[model samples]
Target: MSKPLEITNLYKRFGGLIAVNDVSFKLQPGEVVGLLGPNGSGKTTVLNMISGALPCDGGSVRIGSTDITKMKPHRVAKNGVARTFQLVRPLPTLSVAENVQLSLAFGKKRHWGREARTLAEEKLAFVGLEGRGDERVGNLTYIDQKRMEMARALASEPELLLLDEWLAGLNPSELRIGIDLVKNLQGQGMTVLLVEHIMEAVRALCSRCVVMSAGEKIAEGPSAEVLREPAVIKAYLGDDHA
Candidate 1:
């Protein structure tokens, strides 16, 4: 049986600044939720804490009944979590396939040698990079690099996927493709926590949304209803958008 994610009273501080303040949310299995906020609203901080990239100041994080609040990043990854960065970070010198292979080797179900390579090829194809696996990551276009980032994360075979601004900076066509890719993941039963400023994408992909402002969650509900809230309009979508 799979467990849903539960976060309670999560907190993160940077000296005098409280980046995330007593935040909590529960992700039902197989639900795509949007984490939305204006700049400095602590959206990324929550993700970092959940993914174990940053230690939380105070709070509890649980996957199913397992306590993962203090786990290391790799341990978190091993616990069925995988994430992609807002800024894609590929191993510059590694071929695209090699990069995905590295993720597979360290993922929840670890693979190695020939098995890793075979899995890496499959993941690349999943992300539309099939025949280009041998190309150096540094040589790929920005959109392709983004695909590589997603492929590497998918190689981990996570039950919970944290995507931070994955659709940022894409043109209309690319944005459509990116949205389709995320939808495909959802269709395959992957639960996603997406942090994106693109309202169109959010409305299309998120069943529910959590809106943040000044390190606190101000609104949470169905995507369309949440986006129409006055607080969300003021803090994130802006009056013009509202």
Candidate 2:
């Protein structure tokens, strides 16, 4: 099978700031890959390029067999890519079910009516938000709100899911739950590209991880081994981690 995503010579710049610099990688079908970096290492910029939230200044963003480098963000979603952002901005006025319904309406139409309802319900359940779909999403707890965002993404019936800090602001237990949710999604054959600062969560979920610094990849390989590489340690972890 072909890879779920391939990014080659990717670059993005914000005026004088070089956010993502010539980054490149491939994510295989059914794989969970981690993108690790500090605050300005351009991890999210890479996501923006790959997800079409921001256009890349150079290189290509290919999902499966199609090159979607210059496609609009909405078109990118229609092309089998869905993403959850770090902020988890739920529609304050919309019920959880309605939020997910909007995602379904915008998807590739793999299901509808009862079938769509069933799929949406299943997604909420997968994120551990079962039976709460009727509630206004703004009323949920912070973690639950993030789960709502996740449920919305899953409702897209996506082949690839881009997760930005999927476990960032949670408590220890919430982090565990989030990790389990991601693992369950992976088990269902959804390819995942996770961008996160949580080392433990990344190590736990990612089969392979790519680390970056100053907008370029510094090290990449098996999660545990890569995080421990001397160069990776020095570049990312610095003296304390060493």
Candidate 3:
């Protein structure tokens, strides 16, 4: 079942540099929300904290009614939270199916052997990677690798999915395909928190947006309206543009 994600007072620091400061946001069940900001705006850092890839200096992350602030990455995955990295991460040595099978084995349902492979294939098909399961990850094109990563994330059967620039580096036609893939997830009632710089994809996929700048939230509202905020404009294009 789909679940809501609540991030409260999330704080992160790297020595003297504060990467995130008291950031808070919520993803209601089945809602697609965009987390928008410029580079180094702590958008990815927030995702890391929520996914347990990084430890929070202060704050809490909760999915549904369960607190996951201190959980490790695998624990977080088991709790129905899965994410794709800003950089595509795949085990090049493994076949596409094996990669997703590994994720399925570690997922909430913990399917193994043939069961895992079957479910992995299903996810692969869901991400438009059908019948490419036996192909080596290293041989797949860049966009295909991205699709495989999404398939691997889906193998976990997550309630909440976090995508970090999953649409980056795609051509116009590929971008449309990528946007449609995310739309398919939304149609399936999956809660999504997307960190993207692609305004077109954001406008097409997100109903609402939360804008962050220099580790702080500067704006939040309907996607169209929030993008019109001067603070958001400044955050993206600087003072002169605003």
> Highest TM-score, which number?
3
lDDT of 2 at 112: 62
For model 2, the stretches where C-alpha displacement exceeds 4 angstroms are 1-3, 110-118, 239-242
Q: How far off is residue 16 in model 2, in Å?
A: 1.1
lDDT tens string, model 1, 1-242? 23588999988899999999889899988889999999999999999988999998999988888888999999999998999999999889899999999999888988999989999999989988989888998889888899999999999989899999999999999999899999999898888999999989998999999988999989999998987788888885577766
Best by lDDT: 3
Clash count, candidate 3? 0
How do the residues 92-184 of candidate 3 rate in per-residue lDDT, one tens digit apiece?
889999999999888888899888888989999998989999999998988899899999999998999999999999999989999999999
**Rank list by lDDT:** 3, 1, 2
Name the candidate, 1 or 2, with the larger lDDT value.
Answer: 1
- Candidate 2 per-residue lDDT, tens place, 66-115, comes to 99999988888888899999888788898898788778988756566776
Model 1 earns a TM-score of: 0.97
Candidate 3 residue pairs in clash (backbone atoms < 3 Å): none
Which lDDT value does model 1 have at 224? 88
Model 3, CA-based lDDT: 0.93
Give the TM-score (vs. native) of candidate 2. Answer: 0.94
Question: What are the per-model numbers of colliding residue pairs?
Answer: 0, 0, 0
| TM-scores, each model vs. reference | 0.97, 0.94, 0.98
